[model samples]
Target: MFGRIGRTSVKHPWLTILAWVVAAFALVALAPALKSTTDQADFLPSHYESVQVGKVQERAFPEQDQPASIAVFWRDDNGPLTDGDKADVAKVTESLDKAGFNLVKKIETSPEAVSPNGKIALASVVASVKDPYDEKLLESVKELRKKAAPLLEGTSLKMGLTGSAADALDSQESSGDTDAMIMMATLVLIIVLLGVIFRSPLIALLPVLIIGVVFMVANGLIATAAEVFGLEADASVSAILIVVLFGVGTDYILFLLFRYREALREGQAPKQAMSDAVANVGETIASAAGAVIVAFLALLLSSLGMLRAMGPALAISVAVTLIAALTLVPAIFSLLGEKAFWPSKAWRKQPKHTLGKRIGDLTARRPGVVAGVSGGVLAVLAAGVLTFHPTFDAGSSLPDDLESVVAMEKLQSGFPAGQTDPTWVVLEKTSDGKLEQAEVEAFEKKLAASGFGEVSPGVIGAGGDVAQFAVLLKEKPSSDAAMELVSGKLRDAAHDAAPEGSRALVGGLTAVFADIQTAVNRDYSLVFPIAGLAIMVILGLLLRSVVAPWYLMLAVGLGFGAALGSTVWLFQGLQGKDGLLFTLPVIVYLFVVAIGTDYNILMVARLREEVRRGQNSADAVRHSITHSASTIGAAAIILAGTFGVLLLAKNSMLQQMGFAVAFGILLTAFVMALLLVPAVTKLIGPRAWWPGIKSDTARPAEPGPLLTEAPAGDRASV
Candidate 1:
């Protein structure tokens, strides 16, 4: 099947190229732009208590004056606010409201807004929209800041905004041009690495040009899918998509190129070698991409809409890359023929006694020692997983020097840490009428006594059916402690202490984080196993052996643990961070489990090919490593380099993700695929193929040889 596709592509190279170009252009011009939402609630299902509370708020408090942001006012002299400063604060608030900023509803300040210690004054910046993270609202906050500087010119009061909207804006500004940085870094890394490896500028730059087109097509398709299906992507999707497409696309390109070069070295005609290249490596690439796609698709089981949306989106990208790899790559290379590696005559011959060959010989010579050492290293690193801690504080990922973060710190000096965002415990009538005063009082009292925090008096809506009580937690509202309080004791107290006629629901950012934590935990249990099982099935089908899939999966699983544990050790243990991003485990799992399998698949498939040629188990393992290791190493370095560019991002989440995925790729490529997998397979012997044996002694006829092992006439068809 693969041979047919390759032959057709090579025969009709121009037509194939034209088809891809036209399709990419059409999609780019016609597709709707992908939209993203920063609202945490949007990622949750409507069934979650936090989401339910949001719905109730919309119904019960339609005209609520919910502040989109808060302006913290302090004396420039760093002293208590005097009477003059408080009056100036009110004036500044009024002027900012009247500055004609879009989406600005009203900015209010009162005498009572002064802190008890007289050190600070507060102003609420309410928006016309409910979502504080709305882009327009963030724009309004930005404009308001500009307008305030002029208003406060003559007054002693200085003000800075700190709230959801302002924080989002600051985060956006702090990450300025980061996507450009990542793209540039990735391209430069790939170009440099490829140039160094192939010593051909054309070879280095061609994949970039090809993958660039593939990138646009993948993005257009993703956007069209999102538009048609009404999917909301998270803001981080664009950056992640860039890496995945380029990284994986380059990987597939290298796989084919290596085989093509090998066939050429055997002296086959250009087109024939290209065709044989596709036939030889096609199954391996397809199986590897299939494993990744299925693994990504497994995110459909995730409770969080973010992961659910991400799954299909990433799967679509890999699918496009796979198609391009099997078609466009071969078509273009077939036309270029030997010219693809122009200015470098090295492709005409093979290098001798290289590191890959040395390592391969070592592994085949002493499989047991190599397996024990590699496996032991992974196990020791896996121990760090026990210390893994998850944090939900999005603000912490932003630069501390940002205006919103600095303002938040200042606000905490005169108020509680949770003053910027308080948890809400609502009491509502189960039937229709307004909540009884006694019931509201009882719920508030119970909540305050629940050990979560101090609860404010109930604020009843105009409908009178619901009352909201703000809980100012002792910890920051986004802290792990706050989420724990909301998810555990606070929730139990609210549900259990509600009056007989009324019901209670806990809602707020902390509540949302708690719910997200629950959803992530659920996804870990559900999505990881499903993705792992699905990949194992792919491995089993590809190897035609159930026993081989089990050990391969175990190796990949161990690689994942090692990657995550190493990340946790660097961030939480060495760097003294409170915890990793709440979604770190998910990101690590997807990349490590899926991508890690790619290297393993390539190695095992090569091993199988050598075995089919009637080579002994040890020689097969040695030859597999010797021939496939350089390809794996080069691809791994490029992919890992692309991800490692994320370390350049100021956002800690991106940095952590970058390090984890990059390091994991290196570990999987070097330790697991190159050393451990080959060593273990060697130890397993012919039983590795168990029920589908194809050894020299077991098979009725000798299987086809690899291009390197085949006779000159047979090389064209191999």
Candidate 2:
């Protein structure tokens, strides 16, 4: 099947090339702009309490003023705020209100609650719009910042905006930096690694060029898909797309290059070798990509809209990359010919048995020893899984040096921890009659007495119809204890304490994050099993052995456990973090299980190829390792290193994700792929290919003669 594909592609290389070019241009031109939402509430399912609360608030309190940004002010000289300072703050507030910036509702300056040390004051600026994530809101915040600069030019007060919109802008800027670093690192790693492995600038440059084109096309297509489907991807999707396209694309390229070099060593012409390479590696690349795509697509099962959207987008990307690998890659290589290796003559001859061969021989001779040792090392690491915890605090993921974070900490010390951003208990009239002042007062008193630290009532509906109370909890809003208290006790209290004709709804960041936890939990059960089953089916088809798929999956499972366990050890045990981020497990599971399987497939495919060529089962394991090791090892290192750049991100989530994935790739490539798999293959012997027992018959050897000195006909083939 692959041979046929290789022949056709080599014969019609221009057609293949032209097709890719045309498709790329069309996709780039026609696709809609990709859209992302920074609103955490949007990520949760409508069924979650947070989402329900949000819906209720939107419907009931349609005209409610939402603070788009807060102006945090502190005495630059570390002195107490005197009457002069208070007057200055008032003037600044009046100036902002008079300026009448777009989207600005009003700026309120209050001296009611000054910091205990008397060094700082707060001014809350509410926007007319409800959605804080609105672009107009961000623009207004920026304008406010610029306007405030000169207003306080000679004052001792230092002021900055610190609220949802400001923080979102900061996060977006940081993410852009993170993306740049990740891309630069990945590009350098791919170039250097491919250059070293192939010793050809053209070969090294080809993937960058091809995948670059793929990225532009893929992103454009994803934008169009998102627009058509009305899907909302996370802000980080672009960064992730870069990594996936390059990482997966490079893997496929290496697979083909390895087989191409092998075909060349057998004396095939450049064009024939290119065809043969595609034919041989195409199935493995496709199957590997199928597993990755299925795993990412499984994210559609996630209750969180963000994950559901990401699943399809990433799946689309890998699918495009897979198509490019089989078509565009081969077409380009066919054109390049021997010139692809021009600078490096290493392709003309085969190196003698080296380091990989010795390792393979060791495993073949003592399979049990190798298996036990490798399994034990992973087991020891897996022990750390017991300590794993999940953190829902998005603030914790940000660097502590940010002004909002610092101000938040200071606010925590001086007042109720939730005061910085209180949950709103929105009371809606269930009946047609207007809500009376008596009912509003009674509800406010009940809420205040319900163990809530602070309850501030805003103006009820005109003529005192419906009322709203901003309730502050005693604990940090995003803390687990706080979320539990709010989601369970506080919610119950609010509903029970509401007036007979009015109902209460709790809506805030903490509530949203807690609901996201519920969504993720639901997804774990659905996405994991579905994705695992899908990959198993792919493996079954590719290997033509049900039994092999089971064991292969088990190996990947162990790799997942080991990766999670190692993260737990590093972050929980050593770093003393409260817990892993809530989303880490799923991220780790997808990358480790899916990408890990890529290495496993490459090794196993080679093992099967060796067995088919008439080597004994043990000899096949050894031969596969010797023949396939360098290619797999080089690819793994580059992929792992590319992921490692995530650690450089200022955000903790990215750092954790970067390290976990990088570690998993190292484990999968070096330990699982190189050691555990070969050792286990040696133990399983012929049963590894059970039901397909061509293992019982010694098959034909390679067409080339075995000896160093070849016969005339053998020389022609070799």
Q: Give the top-scoring candidate (lDDT).
A: 1
> How close to the true structure is residue 25 of candidate 2, measured as C-alpha lDDT?
89
Q: Which tens-of-lDDT digit does each residue in 265-342 have in candidate 1?
A: 888999999988888778888998999999999998998989888998999999999999999999999999999989
lDDT agreement with native, every candidate: 0.84, 0.79
Candidate 2 per-residue C-alpha lDDT over 1-718 given as tens digits, one digit per residue, 9 for 90 to 100: 6667778878899998888888888888887778898777888867777777677666556776767767767777757788888888888988998999877789987877566677667788888876677778778787888898999988888777776777666655555577788889999999998888778899888899999989987898889899988999997788889888988888888877777777777888889878767766778888899999999999988888888889999999999998888878888899888899888887676666477788889988999999999888888887877788888876777877776676666556456777666887777788778787778888888888877668897557554455677877888777888888888888899889877766777778777877777778788888888899999999778776777888778788788888889989998888888878888888787667877788888777777666666778788777777766777777788888988988877777777898898998889888888889878977888788777644645788556312110001111111
Mark the 10 consecutive residues where model 2 has the least summed lDDT.
709-718
Cα lDDT over the full model 1: 0.84
Give the Å shift of residue 408 in candidate 1: 1.4
Best by TM-score: 1
